[model samples]
Target: MKTEKRKLAIWMTMEAIEVIGLKRIVLDRDVAEAVGFFHAVIAPQVFATAERFGIHRVDVEETEDGRLPG
Candidate 1:
């Protein structure tokens, strides 16, 4: 089988992430695309959680690797 490369974006924050208790998240868009469904492990809003992690400001960026190295 061949794999196609793809990217996905999900809204999340440092404090609210404990709801699902996921220590890590991995992107597997190829399977997700083919299956036509996927679930995001984190919440898509940072409205209240940011302050708990000392996040004064949140900067958004476009990325390829899906890792927050930048």
Candidate 2:
């Protein structure tokens, strides 16, 4: 028996009153799943950070491209 290997790309953006940043991360299939699971749980804190910064409107853009990994 043989196992197949998979790779993934995860992109995240953070916008706030004082600061804004973008990130492009790559991970294996398993790690990607773990990250996805925690993302929802951690979103509140992320938003809170923006709120603490006095940002009423926080815009975020996220993307994933497994087909184009570099």
Candidate 3:
């Protein structure tokens, strides 16, 4: 279950990156959560990819559901 969730989260994050482009835009965890996976489990992977794309300075804001702010 955890692995599936992680994979789903990674896919979701990648999709978001593809759609939004790896710019200075904030990543709302709510948008990710709506995909139905836990952010904490997938954040490291997402951030890793962002880093690979040279997105070092990320702004992880908190929403009502404690999601990463966009």
**C-alpha lDDT (0 to 100) for residue 50 of candidate 2:** 52
Write the residue-wise lDDT of candidate 2 on 1-70 in tens digits.
9988764333444455212111222233366644654354345565566576665633334325322112
Worst 10 residues of 2 by lDDT: 17-26
Each model's lDDT comes to 0.39, 0.44, 0.51
1-70: candidate 3 lDDT, tens digit per residue: 4555323233544566544533322355355454444344357677877777676635455346645654
Candidate number with greatest TM-score: 3
Clashes within 3 Å, all models in order: 0, 0, 2
Residue range with the least summed lDDT across 10 consecutive positions in model 3 = 4-13
lDDT of 2 at 21: 16
The alpha-carbon deviation from the true structure for residue 45 of candidate 1, after best TM-score superposition, in angstroms, is 4.8
Q: Residue-wise lDDT of candidate 1 within 1-70, one digit each (tens)?
A: 9998655344554455443233222243355442222223232344245555565533334435533332
Candidate number with the higher TM-score (2 or 3):
3
Q: Which ten residues in a row have the lowest lDDT in candidate 1?
A: 34-43
